[model samples]
Target: MKTPPDRSGITFEVGAQLEARDRHKNWYTATIEKIDYDKERVLIHYRQWSRRHNEWFQWSSPYLRPLERVSLRRQGLNAPMFVSGSKVMACWTDCRFYPAKILRVNKDDSYTVRFFDGVVRTVKSTKLKPVDEVRT
Candidate 1:
């Protein structure tokens, strides 16, 4: 691809951790595996995914975004953070965040959430982010 400057204004170097949107519209944590400056293509390896899932995308593709919480909040994607009965993105073992609903909060600040798949689990608050954090 003859890539142009990233429309998102992102300029991440190789090995930078970020988030990438998949074909299904889900955002998953990723790392910049390589960059072909001449071709303007970036090789990304999805966190927790095998090598086969790594992909090459045009540098300017909107499918890529910063994963830093501060950057996300600065983009106006912040909210009350987390609370009971709120919609959230819960991180699973696959390192992919999935949409879930908070059922309650534990004394230790952990949260009991029920994923859309009907699986329930108590996850640390650090492993979750508000669903609104993802700019549709």
Candidate 2:
């Protein structure tokens, strides 16, 4: 793993590993997508993969989700920031984002995002960034 450059507060482009919480609040792997960053926050684009349908879908109506914590797979590598709105390429199967909107910005630096499909989700700031600024 390599260190991610320090681009906090600057809208940068990047790919993200998105996870969604089930009813139990346990995180489950979801789709990865592109993002756009603005200051401390970001706008995320959602990409959804349906196993049952065996296909991929692009969504932009859904708001961005912030990342809480990013960890590197190896030691001493700068972990990736889960910025909002930044675009991410698929590293594996079943990674994508869902179109959503920001309903509210929480005091804990988290956001309440609502999808066009009527799903309201809460995401942290760690998952967003500008679409053009990502390295890959």
Candidate 3:
């Protein structure tokens, strides 16, 4: 079977939660406020920051990304046992939430996450939170 055609000029939806970058390039949790399909841009409000800081970026811009998790590649119609190119916040060594990407998934059901700043460590699943799923 063939995959359905994607919606033209649309990548994300309004009110969808996401991880976004601030002007200083810091990664933070945010939610979609609005979208301009004609321009392919999205307006986002930072979760912890004030509404005054809301900003817009092209919908497909790297600044906007799915919340992260321990992503698996191609389990292919097997058990619903694998998972995304998603973005999520994992507690760093300092216990602060930071934007992290999956470097590896350990057989122990833990993940080896590497922050954008070059810090890497093996972390249990409990310490990770999906970007959109996190309430704050």
Query: For each candidate, what is the lDDT?
Result: 0.80, 0.39, 0.68
lDDT of 1: 0.80
Judged by lDDT relative to the true structure, which candidate is superior, 2 or 3?
Answer: 3
lDDT of 3 by residue, 1-136 (tens): 2321253422366776767888899888788898776676779999878999999887667676665321221222222221323456888878888888777766666677777788887776668887666476
Off by over 4 Å in 3: 1-11, 70-136
TM for every model, in the order presented, reads 0.48, 0.27, 0.45
To one decimal, what is the Cα RMSD in angstroms of model 3 from the true structure? 14.3
Better of 1 and 2 by lDDT: 1
Best lDDT among the predictions, by candidate number: 1
On residues 48-95, what C-alpha lDDT tens digit does candidate 2 reach at each position? Answer: 534442212222212222243322222324433434443322111133
lDDT value, residue 119 of candidate 3: 81
- Candidate 2 structure, TM-score to reference: 0.27
Minimum summed lDDT over a 10-residue window in model 3 is located at 73-82
What's the residue-level lDDT of 84 in candidate 1?
Answer: 90
Please estimate how well model 2 matches the true structure, expressed as its whole-model Cα lDDT.
0.39
Backbone steric clashes in candidate 3, count: 5
Clashing pairs for predicted structure model 3, backbone only: 66-87, 67-87, 68-86, 68-87, 68-88
